[model samples]
Target: MAITSANQLELLQTAEAVAREKMIDPELVVEAMEESLARAAKSRYGSELDIRVSIDRKTGKATFTRVRTVVDEVENHFTELTVEEAKPFKEDAAVGDELIDEVPPVEMGRIAAQSAKQVILQKVREAERDRQFEEFQDRAGTIINGVVKREEYGNVIVDIGRGEGVLRRNEKIGRESYRPNDRIRCYIKDVRRETRGPQIFLSRTAPEFMAELFKMEVPEIYDGIIEIKAVARDPGSRAKIAVISYDSSIDPVGACVGMRGSRVQAVVNELQGEKIDIIPWNEDAPTFLVNALQPAEVTKVVLDEEAERIEVVVPDEQLSLAIGRRGQNVRLASQLTGLDIDILTEEEESARRQAEFAERTKIFMDTLDLDEFFAQLLVSEGFTSLEEVAYVEQDELLVIDGVDEATAQELQARARDYLDEQNKLALEKAKELGVEQSLIDFEGLTPQMLVALGEDGVKTLDDFATCADWELAGGWTTVNGERVKDDGVLESFDVSLEEAQNMVMTARLQLGWVTIEELEAKAAADAEAVAESIAEAEEAGA
Candidate 1:
């Protein structure tokens, strides 16, 4: 192309050297200047003429000059450089490469200088973008030292090494104020390129911020002597960390904690005194889970390894402490441990009651053909005696499984037979034991009296034979929803048929008490014992 002879090429050469000193590749600098000078040429000499800028690849040297053909009469002056001006360059140079007395470096009045300045500024900005992008993009998520540049709308602008970063409003520490030019460190959240420049995001509130502090304070973590498995944080409140060691002898938590908590205290001070739980991690699911639930002593951790879940059973008082206020502690624990944890409590009253009812149940199995599930149901419902279901009629017994009307009737028959046998055996056993045995034991009377005493809350032979005694009396009782007592109830047990009237007279006169039921029961018990003796004798005769 036709070249301009009177250009300022020295300025382009100087700019390249400055770029190399700044760690920028000289070739990249040359390319930038070439494009910028082309833009400047376009603005200076419009589209009517051809202008080109070239840089020597080896020297990173740039030359910006205009090229135009020599025509007889220049219709467009910028497009035609005269032939006399082309004489100094190659005499053999054709129309394209011919030289001319190029435009002199006389200061452009207004437009050209402005155009040149725009070119330099645009080129510099693009160069800076490339430089910053390469430097900081790889450094994302790393900690960096920066100086506070300004604060706007709660966001702080920091000048980190390569570019300015915006520390967003929310990530700032509570109630803390930062002034211009204040030195600080932060986590690099993001690095992005924009029209203006590279935009970097910074954070001071990330839990990784705490982990970083540990790395700085504890050499073991950086050197790989310890490892951090996880961290969970409630920025202004509490945090939990799960840690493990690379070396068997090293305790990851203790290393992070330092002697007497010095290292942890340093981190705490950095966090403005937020509580930290440094927990040791375990490959054993149960043990790891126990450590995750800090402060609360875990008696047991039942882990469902396949489901990745755990049930933490703690004492009743530890329940709240384990769960924390509103479940904050457990929530962080879940985050740190990677296990879903549920908590449970055991009560003594329920346990003792269960044992008591379980013992009552073996006898039931000996007689009833109920399934384990139904047996458990019965136990749960407090039904330990055959008498509980014994008096139940067909409809009530039908409510229990495996018992139809026939079965229910059979159950009632068995219950009655067992009761009868128990009564006979009771007297014989009493005779054998000699605790409360005598022919006078049969001094009670009546079958209905016996049934009522045995099945209708009578509970004892005394309740049957002495129902109307002084001890069985009450001063006031509800009858038809009204409180009333006959005053002679205390002497009701003194009833006798031989002196029925006299006994009544004696009871009413002396003690104002008598019970016909008691006198009857005493006679019946006496007769029951004699019947048992005769049956035994007959069986012996057989």
Candidate 2:
């Protein structure tokens, strides 16, 4: 079939119809049609010739032409023409002017028709995928309604209006099943273009799914009077939402719950009976944790800011309730508060308090050559270590019971004497073990740490670089008859995990260890190099 002037209207109508049906820009369809015609023209004009096609948007006219550049010297006969031969196409043509040769329409044979069809179909499909990707990309992290199209290996395929979204197996709620054609709501987790087409990933078990549901059900949240600070969900079981109010007049939790439990109840119903707890959000983590552990009363909360951990003491009767089945309650609370939580009964807390008191009292007695009575008095006054007593103001020590001016002076002197004696001993031992003075004088490293590392033959920065923070700090060590401290092998460096990792990272950075990103990039580069070497070897043998 030939594209004639009489049929140009029909061609434009066909392009417009396909554009409307596919929901793509009409211009894109016209461009695709032009591309298909160009492919057909290539068969008539040699494949090496620069044949082009364009359809006039207003006139619905298709123009096909061969493009040749006017050149000083003729090279390829199909692409370049000398200035002398180009005068017929353009009267005042220069050496750089592009000449166009108007070509009459030729009837497309069977093979050419088939080629045009494939070209049109491929271009239209690409345009559709691009349009779908753009439409859904902005909808990521939003809830969308769809019908279950099919199931493949536990993954549910949902038919959203404009495109298909895959609810991956791991993203589905536990124990939830969907039949074909069943209506479902899912969160649009991601929208991306891949080899086949645009892929929209959906999720039903995401914490964001529950948060979006609350935004839909609660007017205050939707209006921005209340904000969702965090969400933790155990899909199909229980979930917790932390909400805060910008307007002091409105209570965040109550606003989310609605009158007679109507607002939150709607969210709960949508989650397949997942129990929702609306807790008031607070800048204070302990207060937020107390509220998060609702239905069970908390007696006390001890926070370790350095460790990012909390210890919550509950009454013996409330222990099981605070922990929940399989420790889910505390786990969710931890997630909501962004702190590690350890739940303990009041009795357990008291025992731990006593144990700490004994440990502090022993440290003072051992370090300062103090009697049990004086050590116990110092511990009672909140003096945990000899360094605190040594560095504390004399006035502060005098405030303590039974600590007169002379007694305070004597205590400070003894504490300083003990520290100096210990430092001297550490220096002697370090010298004997060939420990570097630079490591010994490092700011964060203690004298004991240096001595320990020296004994272990980790004397230089390079030697220390080869060791993990746990190893440098010492994890399991023995002293005398019994364990002086069970926290660390060095008996003193009871570093938290964050501190340990920082110490290792610091050492590595100083010693030229690869960063996390650099490590990954290096691994990729090495893999590519190896693949190339193998390809070269294979080619050599071939």
Candidate 3:
């Protein structure tokens, strides 16, 4: 191929056609062509020569040039020249100046033309990939309609207009099969740039997909009058969604359900007949949980906010329904509420309460040296621990049936003596285990807590300061979608996570690891951030 006047305009025409086909900028194609031509020119001349090419954008005229840099020491003989040796190219050539000379365009042979074509194709493909990535990166977390192209290894590849999306087998609803050219609606779960090209991962089982489908079907959700607070899905089996309405006149559940179940049914049909339970969202977690566990009457709801756990007591007859077939209902409800739920039947809850009462009675009987009836009376009166009986107001004990002032006083005295003896024993045990006086005097931690810490090898103040809040207060961790109990060193002492955090921070302050001013500044910053968030949320609500 010769770079003659007849073919000069053909280069620009080819660049425009290729750029239009790839949907990339024409300038990119022209630049690629220049690079490919430069490589061919280098082959035609000398590989050591610095050859360059430029194409006029409008006229497609190719310009070839040989560039030599003026340098003090000419190590690269073909590309660099000393200042005295560059006098012919320029009158004042300095040590850092470049001398350019026009050169004839190369006549590319078959092999050279093939290589140049490969270079241009590679560059054009890279530009196309970049364009696709930029186009889909912002479109993530949205719904797109695509046509199924093919299936490879159980993964469905879809043509999602200007890009290809892979819907992995795990991301598809149960038993969903698609043929070529089948139209599909998918959620754009992720977009990533990789060595191959842009990867757009599509999902049909994602909870957000259901939320978006509801948004499409329910006008109120799209208008922000109704908000989808939470969604939990079992993919093709069942799902739960909690919604709230800002307008008092609008019922979120009714609006989502639509007239004659039209709106929800639209979403369900798209999900391959997945069952959906629409519940009204409440600011109160327990109330929301009750709503989430609909169709099953909840007798009681006890929530432990710090642990993010809830206990629900339902009628025995409704136990199976609350737990669903294979515990799906409760699992979805737990996910919807973002809490670990433990559902118990009415009879089981009653039995558990009775057992707790008996256990508390036994503790009072053994520690306070009281008879069974007196211990039962103390347990029934809401004194669970010796600390409560020892430190509580004497009038609280006196309020118990048949308990006079003298009896209350005697009872308090015995309880205090028992607690003191236990504390003394615990202190001795902690000291035996190498507990330091610094830890004992640091405050906030009781004698039993110190013993627990010492047993756990946290014998020094430094060790206490290095301890994490979760290590001092028990917590639950999700492993493989199941909540696992994590035992804390001081959990038996009933130390909450906040109390543990404060104690550790105080220990750090006492050890000069942190200053009070830093703590105060951090607290102020956190308070300001929280205030800003609240203001933003209020504005959004309005």
Candidate 4:
């Protein structure tokens, strides 16, 4: 049924063959051909014109129809068709639809045949590029094979099958060189197309470059006994891979190491002698955190779950090693774990615990009650004992974001309850750990001073600590309307002019109405009332 003369008939087979050799689908190639021909036609004529092509499955016969845009004033004859002229075949054709005209065999001369050939070839190339683009784009960070073409702009151009891929300067592994026509394998980073053609961008710098190489060398990785979850690299210098396995019987780290690290050694050699650390991936945050800070054993892990922070404590000897030079160890671990990791030495941990202890104690005195988050905050602060909190100073505790007056009071009460219980359990422990309880001295402001203020009541340390430090002397802390100078307490306490001015503002979280001056004025009024009562009593006695 098929004729021998059909180069026309064999056209479909030829197209399919081209697509196959390139690992491209025939249907896709056909689509690409159609798109390319359409593009070439529009470029030669105008975008206002349309071209359509059809291929016969039986004989490979192909045809092209020119479609013109309907317009009143036709400047471009190839595209714009006069409204009345396009009325026949253009019935349903709107402004956007094309008025297609069939070109006779005679109209397609030898030159036209040549032009058609160019269009088809150009289109086929573009389609091939697009197909390659779609195929390799998602394959970024994967290994692919290509031959070195030549160097340009200090970069290597690798011929990747259907496309010419570039290996940019920075993407080249350090000291790793290749010559023209040399067969090389690198990672496919990005794939795109330009006027030049399909670019199957290759890289030796991608983190997975090494992983892929290891996959080829290590059978276990190919067999799925080992899985690489993440990788980080200082390309050409050193690389680290985080791997895990499904079976508990299998050790990811050991498997990658091979019989004697030969498998991994081969990969390292391919990297031009780059150092590699094969650390075990872990699900336990603590265990994972410890492993992530490899080469240095972690003694403890303090985790702030809500904040996604982890503090890794190591022995004094391992501190420097764990943190690495200039904090590289912790920095890379943070990247690997995807967590903000803080590395601490034993001494640092101990000091931090003590400081945190002071913070909680202050919080207890100011605010009563401990929430889970606050407790975590306390832990992060480095507080290990309740006694330490009892004696904590305001300056130290104020640094924490959430430790307000109320929270401080709660912690103080809890610390008291805790101390009492401990005292009952071990008098010796109580003696050794002397209970520290200090009444918050509101400078010299008596309870009477607070009672004198109206609905504007004192509730927070800001209310009390609002006492300007510059006010060397203090009665009831006074605040001027906007400045601290006008507070009655300022004069009563004989505070410095600077201190009174500071109180007027209550800098951190200043109150507009009830400032230092307002509170000081009320304190003065209360003091005057007490004085008057004393005088009246004396006069009545006389």
Error of 2 at 186 (Å): 1.6
Ranking by lDDT: 3, 2, 1, 4
lDDT of candidate 2? 0.85
Write model 4 residue lDDT over 287-317, tens digit each, in one string: 8878878899988888965346788889999
**Per-prediction backbone clash count:** 28, 3, 0, 33
Candidate 2, position 483, lDDT: 27
In candidate 1, how many Å is residue 312 off? 2.4
Judging by lDDT, tell me the better candidate of 3 and 4: 3
Off by over 4 Å in 4: 1-104, 107-114, 135-141, 193-196, 356-542
At residue 314, candidate 2 shows an lDDT of 99
Identify the leading candidate in terms of lDDT.
Answer: 3
Alpha-carbon TM-score of each model against the true structure = 0.55, 0.83, 0.94, 0.55
- Give the lDDT of residue 358 in candidate 4: 65
lDDT score, residue 119, model 4?
Answer: 62
Q: Which stretches of candidate 3 lie over 4 Å from their true place?
A: 478-482, 521-542
Looking at model 3, residue 224 earns an lDDT score of 94
Model 4 accuracy (lDDT, Cα):
0.67
Candidate whose TM-score is highest: 3
- Candidate 3's clash total is 0
- Give candidate 1 misplaced runs (Cα > 4 Å): 1-9, 17-23, 43-50, 57-109, 302-309, 347-374, 377-542
Q: Which scores better on lDDT, 1 or 3?
A: 3
